[model samples]
Target: MSQRHVLQVFEQYQKARTSSCQTVAELANRPQNVETLQNAGVMSLLRPLLLDVVPTIQQTAALALGRLANFNDDLAEAVVKGDILPQLVYSLAEQNRFYKKAAAFVLRAVAKHSPHHAQAVVDCGALDTLVICLEDFDPGVKESAAWALGYIARHNAELSQAVVDAGAVPLLVLCIQEPEIALKRIAASTLSDISKHSSELAQTVVDAGSIAHLAQMILNPDEKLKRQVLSALSQIAKHSVDLAEMVVEAEIFPIVLTCLKDTDEYVKKNTATLIREIAKHTPELAQLIVNAGGIAAVIDCIGSCKGNIRLPGIMMLGYVAAHTENLAMAVIVSKGVPQLAICLADEPEHHIKAASAWALGQIGRHTPDHARAVALANVLPRLLSLYMDAESSEDLQVKAKKALKNILQKCTHLPALEPLLHDAPPNILKHVVGQFSKVLPHDSKARRLFVTSGGLKKIQEISAEPGSLLQEYINTINNCYPEEIVRYYSPGFSQTLLERVDQYQPVI
Candidate 1:
C-alpha cells in the first residue's frame, strides 16, 4: 500500500528463486502499485530485475516500468535516467520471446513520449536492434519492434534515416503484406511515419517497391490502415510529378476513388487531400481524377464538418477547375460558384479564401455569363476586400486581383463594367466592345448609350489601322451603326464620293 512496502516486496522478490517473484512483479504491474513503485524511485530497483533469470520477472518488471513511463515526462525521464535503454536493447535478442516483446513495448512507450526520449533510445542503439527484430521469427517481437520503430521515426529525422539505412524499409513492406492483419496495419502505419520525414526517405521506400504493395493494401477495407496508406501515398506524391505519375501508374486512382466512398471521415478526407496534391502538378493528371468522378466527391467535402477536410476540398475543386474549360463549367453547374463565394466571404482561413477566389475567377474566365453569375452572388465586394487587405498574403491579394479583372472584364453589369472599361487594357477593351456589339443590334437604347459615351469614336480610332486585329470588330460597328451616323462620323467613306471616284477612274 505504501512506497516502502512495495520497495521491500520488490527486494524480497529479487532474492527469491520462486514464482513469488512473478507474483510481486505482477502486483507491481497493477496501476495503483506501479504509481507507488514509480513515486518511490523504484526504477533503480527494477533495472536489475529487467534481466532477471526468470522470464516472468523480467517481463513484469519491463511492463511495470513501461506503464509508469507512459504516464508523463517526468516518469519517462526517470526511466531513461535509470539506464533501462541498454538493457531493453539487449533484451531484444533474448532467448525468451516474452522478454523481447516486453522490452520492445517499453521502448516504444519511452520513445514515443518526446523526440528527446526517442533520441535517447537511439543514442542507446535501439534503432539497429529494432531493425533486426523487424525480421524476427516471432510475430509478437516483430510487431512490437516495428511499432517501436514507427514511434522513433515519427519526429526524429536521424532515427528515420538510421532505420532506413539499417534496411528497415523492405522488411516493413514485407510485413505489410503478410497474413497477420494486425502486423500489416502496424507496418503500414510505420511506413507512413517514415515517409513523412523527407522526400528522400519516402523515395527510398517507394524505390524499394512499396507503392504497389500500398496500392493493394488500400483496397483491403481496413479503415485505419487505409488512412495511413493514403497519407503515405500523398506524402510521396507531393514531392515530385514523376512520383505522382508512379502512383497513377500503379493504378492507384481507382483505389483512391473507392476510398472517397469510405464510411470513415478521415479516410474520405485524406483521399480528397491526396487527389488535390496529384491534381496540382498537371492538367492531364488532374483530368485523370476528374474522369474518375473525383470532382463530385471533392465538391461534397467543401462542406465537411472538419475545417481541414473542407479546406482541401475547396482547394481541390479550385485546382480541378483550373485544368480545363469543361471542368470549370462542371464546377459551375454543380453549384460550386455560390459555395466558393461562401468560402471567400466567410471562411476564416486566408488561404482558403484565396483559393476560393482564384477558383471563382477560373470558372468565370471561360465566358461572360459565368463571370456575371459569380459577380451576381455579391462576391465582387468580398474579392475587392481581400485584394485590398493589407494583412492578406501576397498570394491571396494576387488571386483576388486576377479574379476581379476577369469578372469585371466579362461582367455585363453596368456598374461593374463601366469603371473597368474606363481603364481597360487593350484585350479587355476588345471583350467589352464585343459585349456591346451583341446588345446594340436589338436595343436602340443600347446603341444610343454607346454612341453618346464616345464609344463610336473609340471604335473609329480602332479602325484607323488597316492591319489591326480590331479591324473585324470595327467592321461590326460600321455595320451596326445607322447609315446617317456612319456617314456623319466618317464622310471619307460616303457612297456618293465613292461613286464620283469610280467615274474618274483611269483606263488601261
Candidate 2:
C-alpha cells in the first residue's frame, strides 16, 4: 500500500471501535508493517494517541510505535525526535496497566537500537520513572522497564553512571532475587552491562550488593542468564585487584569454574576468560581459583574446547603458575605441562604458540622441579624449532627462546642442544653457548652430549671470528670444563705455532 493509504488506515483505526483498534495495533506490530507505518508517518499520528482518553487506543498507538522502533536506529531517532520520549516517560506512571507496559516496551526498543536514542531517553529523565516501574505490580511492566534501563546503561559510561546515579543498582539487585525468572534475567543483564562500562560504575553496582545476587543468579539453569552474570563478574574482575578479590571473596569462583563445562560455547568461553582475569590479580587470588578446584576446569578447557578458548585456557594455566609455587605445583600435578606441550606441537596460530610457549616458561620459572616437568614434556624441540625459524617474528622467537632457556635451566636431560645453535639468530646462538658453558662442568651427560653434538666446536669456530660475542662463553667453557678435555679440544689454538712447538708438533 502507498504511504497515503497506510495513513488513512491509521486514521480509520483512531476512530474505530475498540476491537478494531486492537486489530490495527496487532497489524501494525507485524514485521512487514513497520515500513508502511514509518513511511506513512503513522508514528507521528500515534504520538498523540499515547495520551488518548480511551486506554485501548493508547495501547495500540504505543505498542505500534514500539514495534517500529525495535532494531531500527533511524526510526528510534525519529521517535525520540518526535518528542515522544517524555510522553512515554509520563505514560510510565499511568494508572492503566497496559499503557505503562506499552510505554516501557516503546522506550526499550528505542533505547536498545541506538546509542543516540539511549542518550535521548536518559536526557529526558527516564531513569527515575523506570526505577519506579521496577516495583510495578505487573511482572511484564517490571521486565520491560528493567530491560529499558539496561539498554540505556549498555550504551556508554556517562549514561551507565546516570543509571546508577538514579538508583537503579539496588533495584536491579532486588529484581535478581525476585521469583520472576524474566525480570531477574533482565536485571542481571543490566548489572552486567553497567559493570562493563567503567570500574567506578562497576564498583557502584558491587557496592550496592549486586555481586551476591548475581552470583546466586548463576545457579539457575538458564544458559543465557548465566552467561550475562558470568560476563559481568569477569568485567568487574578486570577492573582492579580489589574487585577481583571481591569476586573471589563472594565465594563465587567455584560457580564460575563449573561453567567451564557449560554446553554453550559462549558460556564456556566467557568462563574460561573469567578464570584468566581473576587469576591474574595475585597469588592469593590464583590460589583461590586453585583451591576452588578451578585448575581442573582450566585444564579441561585447554584440552577440549574449540575455537579461541584453548589459547586463553593455556594462558590461565601459565598465569597461575607464575603466581605461586603451590599453584604452579598444582598445574604440574594437573598435567598442564603436557597439554601446553601439545598446544605448541599442534602447529597452531602464532598467538597460540606465543601464549603457550610463554606459559611453559612461566611454569618453568616456579622452581627447578617445575622446570623439569616442562622439560619432560619435550617442548624444548618445538620451542627450538620456532626460535630457529628465520621467518618467525621477533616476539615469537623471543618467547620460544625464553621458554627453552627456562626449561633447560632445571633439566639437563634433553636431545642435542647443538642443533638449536645451527643457523640460530645471533642472540639465540649466544644463549645456547651460555647454557652449554653453565652446564658443561656440573653435568657429565650434558658435557658428553654437548661435545658429541658438535656445539662446543661450533662455539669454538664462532668465537674465533672478529668481534664475536661468543668469546665470553668460550672463557666460561675453558674455565669450567674438565681441564684435560679442554686441552685436547682447543690445544692452545690462539697461540703462535713456533711458540707451541715445545708442547705441540709444528707443521712442516
Candidate 3:
C-alpha cells in the first residue's frame, strides 16, 4: 500500500472509530499522518473528534497524541489542557493491567515533552500511586511507572519534591539495590533527574542512604550500570557536600581508582571527574587519592588514554598536585616525570599535553629539590621536542610554548637547566632557546645579563663566589646590550636579579 493512501485510510478509520472501538490501531497508524496534519493545519479539524474519542478511545488516542507531542507544542498543549490528562490519570487506577501500563507509558511521554502536564500528573496524586506500581507484578508496568516518574521529576521540581515527600527515596533506593540491571539503570537515571532539580531530594536520597547503594553499583559487572552510577554520583556530589565527603569517607578511592582502568571511556572519564569533585570540596581527600596510588593511575590515564578520559584524568592529577606538595612529590617519586615526558612526545591532543605540562609545572613549583629531580629525569628535552614539533600547528604550538615557558620560569636553578644545555637533543635545545627568548622578560638589563651569563650554572658552581659572578654578569649586560635588547630578554627577571645584586653587592 502507498504511504499516503495508508495515512488517508488511518485518518478515516480514526474518525469512524471515534464512536466505536477504543482500540489504538487507528492512532498508532496516525503517526504517519503527523506531517500531513501539521502541514495542512488540520489539527483544529481533528480537535473535536479527539476530545469526543478520548474517553472511549483513550489508549489509542493517548498513544497517538504522545507521538504527536514531538511535532508541535500547540497540539500537545491542546491535548493536555483538554480532557486527555484526567483520562490518563484515571487509567492509572484501572483494574486492567494492560490499560494501566499503557496509560503510564503515554503519560511518561507526555511529561517528557510538556512541563505543563507535570504538575497535573503530580496533582492527580500519581506520585505515591506510581511508587506502588514500581512493584507491579508485570515488569512492563513497573518499568513504565519508573520511566514516567523520571520524566515527571525532570520537568517538575514540585513533582520531584512530592516524590521525595511521598517517601519515594526508599523505593528508588530499592530499585538501585535490585539485581536486575535494567531496573537499576532506570533507578539511576530517575535519581539523576530528580537530584538534578532538587538538592533537597538529593540530600534525602543521601540521607536515605543512596550513596552506598550507588557506590555498590559502581562495581556492577554491567558496564551500562557502572556508567549510570558514575553519572549519578557526579550529580549527587555536586548537590551535597556532606554526601561527597561521605563518599570519600567510605573509602571509595580504590573503586574509583579501578574505574580509571575501565574499557568504556566514558566510565573512566566520569569516574575521574567525580574524584576531582570530591577532591575539590574536601582537599584532604587528595591524600587518600595519593594513598590509593591514584597519581600513577592518573598519569597512566593521561599518557595512554585518549579523548574524554585523558583530559579528566590529567585534570585530577593537576588538582592533586595543586592541593598538596607532598602528593606532588609523590608523583615525581613515582616516576611520573618519564610517563609525562613520553606523553608529551606522542600525545597530539593540545589540552591533554597542556594539562600534563601544567601538572609537571605544579610538581616543579613544590620545591627546588623536586624541580631538580624532574629536570634530572630528562623531562625538559622531551617538552622542548614537543614545542618544536608543534611550532607550525596553531593549537599545540601555543600550548607547548606556554608549557615550556612555565617549566623554565619555575625550575630556574642550574641543576635543572644544565642537562637541557648539555645533554638535550640539539634540535630541542634550539627550541628551548627559541621559547626562552620569547618568554624571558625584556627591559630588565640586570636580569638579561644574569640569564645570559649562565647565572643558573654559576649558582651551581660551588667554588664561584655568588656576589662576584652576579656583579660581573650585571655589569656585562648593562654595558654590552641595548636597552631594547635587555628589555626584550628579561623584563620580569630583573627584580629578583636586582634584589640578589643588591644583597650580594654589600656582602662581597
Q: Considering TM-score, which of the candidate structures 2 and 3 is the better prediction for this target?
A: 2
Worst 10 residues of 1 by lDDT: 414-423
Tens digit per residue, CA lDDT, model 2, 1-508: 9999999997776567456556657766677876776787776677777777788778888887888788478788888889999988877786477888888888888888767788888888789999999888888888888889998999899888889889888888888888887887788888888999878988998898887777776667988888878888888888889998888788786767778888887788778877888888889888878888888888987777654768768888988998878888999998888888888888458878888899999898756678768777777677888987887778888899888777666654435455566655566666667666667768777667777776665666564444465677677776766776665566455464456667886569
Give the 10-residue window scoring lowest on summed lDDT in candidate 3.
456-465
How do the residues 1-508 of candidate 1 rate in per-residue lDDT, one tens digit apiece? 9999999998776567335445545666566776676666677867888777777778878876777677667778998888888988877776477878878888888888898998898899888888888888888888998999898889767878877887899999999878887788889888888887777888998988999998887777778888888887887787778878988898986657877767788887778778988888888888888787777767766655445556767777778777777777777777788888877887777787887888888777767677777777778777776777889999999998888777766666543443334545465556656665566667777667767776665566543356555566567767887777776666455687778888996888
Candidate 1's C-alpha runs over 4 A off are: 1-39, 303-306, 323-327, 342-370, 382-508
Mark the regions of model 3 whose C-alpha exceeds 4 Å error after superposition. Answer: 1-33, 37-57, 70-83, 113-128, 154-159, 197-199, 239-241, 249-253, 334-364, 369-409, 413-508
Residue pairs in candidate 3 whose N, alpha carbon or C atoms collide under 3 angstroms: 24-60, 441-489, 441-490, 441-491, 442-487, 442-488, 442-491, 443-486, 443-487
Local lDDT at 490 for model 3: 49
Return the TM-score for candidate 2, rounded to 2 decimals: 0.78
| Cα lDDT over the full model 1 | 0.77
What is the C-alpha lDDT profile of model 3 across 174-211, one tens digit per residue? 77876677888888888877777656777877787888
TM-score of 3: 0.65
